[model samples]
Target: MEETSSATMKAAVGKDYGEIRDMVEVVDDQPRPGTPREGYLVVKVLACALAPGDNRVLSGRTKMVQGPPAFPYVIGGDVCGVVHEVGENVEGFKPGDCVVARFFTAGPRGGLAEYYEVKATLTEHKPKTLTPVEAASLASSGTSAYIAVENTIKEGQSVLVLGGGGGVGTMLVQLAKRKKPSFLAVTTAAPKVVQDLGVADHVINYEQENWWEVAEITDQAPFDVIIDLGQGVSAWKVARKYNLLKSRGQFLTFVGDHHVLWAQGIFQIFQSMGPPLWRSAWTPCIPGVPTFRWQLDGLPDKREPLTNLFKLVDEGGLRVVLSNGSPFPFTTDGVQSAMEQLATRKAHGKVVVKVAEE
Candidate 1:
């Protein structure tokens, strides 16, 4: 790895975990990342996408699981940038190469900085068709969607995506569409935007009516797969109560009742895993219970899925959906606003912050 002249750089710094507006501020004195360690690259960040996990860390909601962040922590995960330096044992990437990556193991010390050190395994060449903001938006959410759709949806099956207007949800809808489901539906507040994608057979405005009661959706009850991006187990309970899943269908969720788990302390975290494990073990024996699953964002290898995502983009089969007023300026107020918007959990799509020009 090569050395850079600057010893410090500007970054969105979180002084402590509490509130987005109260905790985060832009500072110029943060130490610039030095040489990339082995199998890592130092990225000159162009943009960073904000996610609910960033807010969770900033607000201390994930403290129990993640532990307290180091003070003046830089919180971001999804990053698009030019490689500034490459470490020994790394290949296929070099300085000045545009890339997108997720700092899945970096925790709070992540890509909100001017320069971020990322594992080469988590990085991919940025698709030519995507802008810095779009590329930044792809890593975390895109990979999650890719994993979910690849593992769950099958051809000729009926599918329903909860929170289909969200970052991961949008990607799931697009990827699932290619599977050619017999019936496809989504529940979202931004029905117009999702409907315009021309994938879903029915778009249920979850705000306007109960999705389960909507005639179009009810008629398609017993969905072959239910992918929940945000509703968590609440949606699962509803699906079970209403018999909305096929006997052998799958219910996949990316979010969990972590607040409850966190409140119960570390011991209960292990204890709480019991129900999901027990359900997984017994669901096949039960008559109507769909296989219940909890999906986490961490992936063993992100490179292949990211490459596939870029291919989808290049092929015009996928796109990054940004929320309104996104690509927020990279500043104290800008990052604060972005985090707040993500906290609402109502942003129609991904929220991104522009850190530098391409």
Candidate 2:
């Protein structure tokens, strides 16, 4: 195992909760991760991908749910890097092996640093066909997309992805296409980008037209599956109002109308959880209505999903979509710019920060 010579490392850190630009800064003196504990590996991070959730943690928007931010909180979760040290009980990984991992730590520390400690269970060998940045994009978003597609998509089913341009959404579109859906449609502002993928049968520009009102989309109404990635609409209400789902159809959401949660304070957010739970549990009782579900939790085991996702990638069935000006340098300004782009919710694809040279 190669050992880091220094006891400290440079990291993009959130000193306190407020704004990404204000709170995120690079520091050279942050303590470097030491030896891994059992079932863990200490990784020398090469690149990290930014997600909307990182903004929530840094901005104190989800403080009530996630607790207060730890001072000098690192600001990334999806990481791709080389394994530096493997702890006891860890197998199939060794020092110098390139890997990708998702760190689900409290306060969300680890990814942005020069070194991070991650569980072996959540880590996987990076596909040779993908760069570190591309591999980094998969750990979280790909896992979510894989699980959603596995659970909801089936051959000959009709699928619609609301907001299909972000990190998770783009991957979802690709994964859903592999399922050989009878019809695949996506609502996205980046119509050109999504259309270029050639996976979706219809790309409705939500910015230019109301997706539900569009004849092409509505004509394909009563979809078998609708996956919402927070496109500023009440997916459940829309599904019910427009009769968008077939009987026993499934409605899955990573986040439903997050603007309400962001605009309203902590109490409102906590209060909002109730209705989803109620609906997810009881909505099926009604005839002809789709089942409501919230996909907020991470999969308990990611190995199989990641293995399948990587195999698909190796076959050229999937690829990471990088936003403009991505592969941002590992600096304060670079990370701030990346996070700022992510906060806008307008990035065509994944925003990534290159932490070190591969």
Candidate 3:
């Protein structure tokens, strides 16, 4: 081993919020791995997904970027990569394991790098049906939907997915059907895709502006279960329309922080009429049954939530849309166009960036 044993890595680095191309600089020799060198494992990052969050994190609109250990950060969350090196004392996973993960706290310095370190638990084996980029897209949206359906729902209940054409909505609409919900509906901006999935018994397009008039989801009045993984006010309005009291309904959304989630949970305690349930849901960092290939945070195989989901995908319960085209490459020059395209959300599915040839 060379004395210092420092290795070079490529990352999309930035100091300020701007277009991905304008701010990203590919510098050489930025050192391979950092401390916790004991538990840490370095992955040769392959493909990552682009979402609206990337724009927010990069532009500082989301206020998600934390202090220090910040800036010059790579802005990506959904990722899939092959194991290049493993820290000593780390067991279960070996070099070359391909894992999927969400680099939540780490940011660009996190998933977007050509190589990055991850705790073993966040990664899982890619579903056989998915490519790297498609698998990467599953972390936040796929798993959140999985958790929502499994945890909060019951069979023969009426369900609605607000902002239905989104990644989460796409998965939720399908997975919720697995429970044989009585009524399943999804709302989206795209009318055609809603028609194509056929998972939703009813589909409403928000683009029409008159969308709400026909969106009266129930003739009997209000849905039994509501999953709102979209905007906040929109969620509150829909909840008021369809939610029933004393019926034990489940509402899922991205609303609420640590405090808000607990507070909303309390309202469910006192109200006889269903007082709104503010869903503050997160994708599991752990793997579930059927065993995924990649493990981060801990042994990859040890995580149950992710592995369980894989089994579902394998069994045809969970579905991830694999978009056409090669993943956008992970180079400094190409990223500008990728980020610009990401902003448009014109692409039918999650945009992928291929970091390294696998």
Which one is best on TM-score? Answer: 2
Assess the local accuracy of residue 312 in candidate 2 as a C-alpha lDDT between 0 and 100.
87
Clashes of each: 0, 0, 28
lDDT of candidates 1 onward, in order: 0.83, 0.84, 0.60
lDDT of 1 by residue, 149-210 (tens): 88998899999998899878887899999999999999998998798788999999888889
Deviating ranges (above 4 Å) for candidate 2: 1-5, 257-266
Model 3: runs farther than 4 Å from truth? 1-6, 25-29, 34-36, 62-68, 104-109, 209-211, 241-248, 255-302, 322-326, 345-348
Q: Candidate 1 has which clashing residue pairs, if any?
A: none
What is the TM-score ranking, best to worst? 2, 1, 3
Q: Which candidate model has the greater TM-score, 1 or 2?
A: 2
The residue ranges of model 1 lying beyond 4 angstroms of the native Cα positions read 1-5, 106-108, 257-264, 267-274, 285-288
Tens digits of per-residue lDDT, candidate 2, 1-358, equal 2333589888888899887777899888888888899999999999999887788777776676654435877778789999999999999999999999987664355688899899898899999899999999998888889999999889999998999998889999999999999899899989988988889999998889888888877889889999998753477788879899888999998885454344236566757676676778887798867888888744665478888888889888687899999999988999999999988888889999999888
Worst 10 residues of 1 by lDDT: 256-265
The lDDT leader among the candidates is 2
Give TM-scores for every candidate, taking all chains together and pairing residue i with residue i. 0.94, 0.95, 0.76
